[model samples]
Target: MLGADFYMPTRVFFGENALQRGKEMLLKAGHHAFIVTGKSSAKKCGALDEVTTLLQEGGIPFTVFDGVTENPPLLTCFEAGAKAAACGADFVIGIGGGSPLDAAKAIAAFAANQGMAPMDIYDDAKRLCPTLPLFAIPTTAGTGSEVNPYSVLTLEGGMKKKTFKAPDSWPRAAFVDPRYAYTLPHGATVSCALDAFAHALESYLSPKSTVFSQTAAVFAAREIWDVLSAMPGEFDVEMRTRLALAATVAGMAISVTGTGFPHPLGYSLTLLDGVPHGRACAAFAADYITYNEKSDEGRALIAAFAAAIGTKPNVMKAFLPGVAEVDFSFTEAEIAERIELVAGAGNYQNSPYVISKEEMYAIYRAHFLKK
Candidate 1:
């Protein structure tokens, strides 16, 4: 009796030269394009060059906003949106990892609805104005922002990261050329893979998971884990392709179930402790899986996930420490305060079981304090 409504509208073009499709999508979406990206990776990976060449060849006017940072701040979106509005750009092209892609969605919203306050990006109760059409070109294999409507924004003066989704915020198209990932650093590749795997793992264990979402999650978990386990060696084009596809599939899965504890609780570590977004989220994933598996209700779900990935339930734990470590130092009171934040998160209640404050604290302790 699996029942869930799934919404995925992004037209994905995945292959070695898939980016050539961006020219047509951009042309169809708008006359002028606003390209959003981070400072380095997009430029380093050659995605920027390829995309720009396509736009140029297509005779489409465009502008590049490369101010997006890791854990992108709301100000950056506001700034880029204002720029886009001023330039009369009709569409957005997000060309990087999750940060840029997420920021691009927010930028499109802000750009189109120039009259709305910046904080209104989080007003889920209000019907938001439609965003400019967006096209994503992912240079990294994680966060899956390319295919989802969620845009995770880090507010400058806020305690936790926030996300907003307008129906039109889903990217109109995505160019997932795994060859773009060939230039990724080893550590970044591993971290992104872990992030992708966490998405699959968390969503698969969600109480709201449907058969379709679970299938996508399981496939993503296996694909990400297998490629990640063989890293430090040069990645052939096929391996990179599979890894990128894994992240995208994971993103699609989470779009249906949303995320659970790891993502909500991981925000503090990422924002406050300067942990990488993927690594921070993954730090808590293993314990959460164990927590779920030990419960009567979650045992079947855990077994299903293990079978899908072709491994024991705890195999992820063995791989996690190799990807990222919990090295933060926090006092008991500070730890309690962080736990309170997790308790207040919207997605905290999305866990398969009701998470008591004590249990939440224990999960954090298992990852950080004990390590």
Candidate 2:
């Protein structure tokens, strides 16, 4: 039997011209909008320009804080929040990829409680203040931070990547214009699509998964897999649109069920090895599939999930290997050290089975260490 509860708060607008709805979401959010984004993608993609034009034409005042970087640090979030507070920003608009969108959520939380210390943001009890309303415009197809309340932040030291989730942290609305992602490079397209697929896969396999979440995950996974498999030459605008929808659907599923082992296991690869978040997670997924297939119960669940996505279990597992290779190399001892890091993550409990340290280390060594 599946879990009982399902909840997703963000009002999503998907497709080619979704940016047109931004003016309406902005008006409903507040008067002054603090736009949080990366240094370049937003401008290069023309999302920032379109949003700025909408705000100006609508007579809405706004400020742009473009300091958000890849794998956004907690200190950067604190600084961005301070900027929002100092400027009296009533609502926040997050543009670009997952980093900016996740930063926007944290910035909203921190801006509401400007008195709280940077580290204090992690203390759930201290997050009592109402977060500023957020409107998201995602330029990339991965991360799906627009629709989810959880904000994955790498703290100041960059050693720990943690999630800060609050009910109020969900974006009030999301404008997912795939047109903004039309020019995304080939590497990013593959990595991001795989990330969305990973989100759906992990959420479906999570012990907390509900029927509703599984439905969303299956649909999203099918879209991602099909689109990824059918890429002919260069990625066109239509491909971007499909990937965006897959990401959004996957985001909604993860919001309800959260992710399982791969995400927690993949974090060290990203933080330590400098692997991109999507590819790092991808590197662990093949091992995750193999591990799950070891038990009859796991095999049954995998079969159902595979059926939902229109494939056999063995074939699905075979396709995962391509997405699971990374460029980093480590020795046996180094791999063991990294395994310890994953053991500390709280998300381990969400895995369908009890994952022992030995099992976790084996998975790490098998996927990460070259033979």
The number of the candidate with the highest lDDT is 2
lDDT of 1 at 331: 75
Candidate 2 to truth, TM:
0.96
Tens-digit lDDT track of model 2 for 1-371? 77777777888888766868545767767889999999999999999999999889888899999999888999999988999999999999999899999999999999999888988888878877999999899999988888899899998778778888887999999999998888788888888888898899988888778888889899889988888777546887777788899899999999987887778888888888877778877877766777777777676778888888888877766666565558566789888778876688876676556577888877877666767
TM-scores, each model vs. reference: 0.94, 0.96
lDDT of 1 by residue, 28-76 (tens): 7778999999998898989998878888887889999999988888888
Q: Model 2: how large is the Cα RMSD against the reference?
A: 1.6
Clashes of 1: 0
Where is model 1 more than 4 Å wrong at Cα? Answer: 124-128
Segments in model 2 whose C-alpha atoms lie over 4 Å from true places: none
Report the Cα lDDT for residue 100, model 2: 94
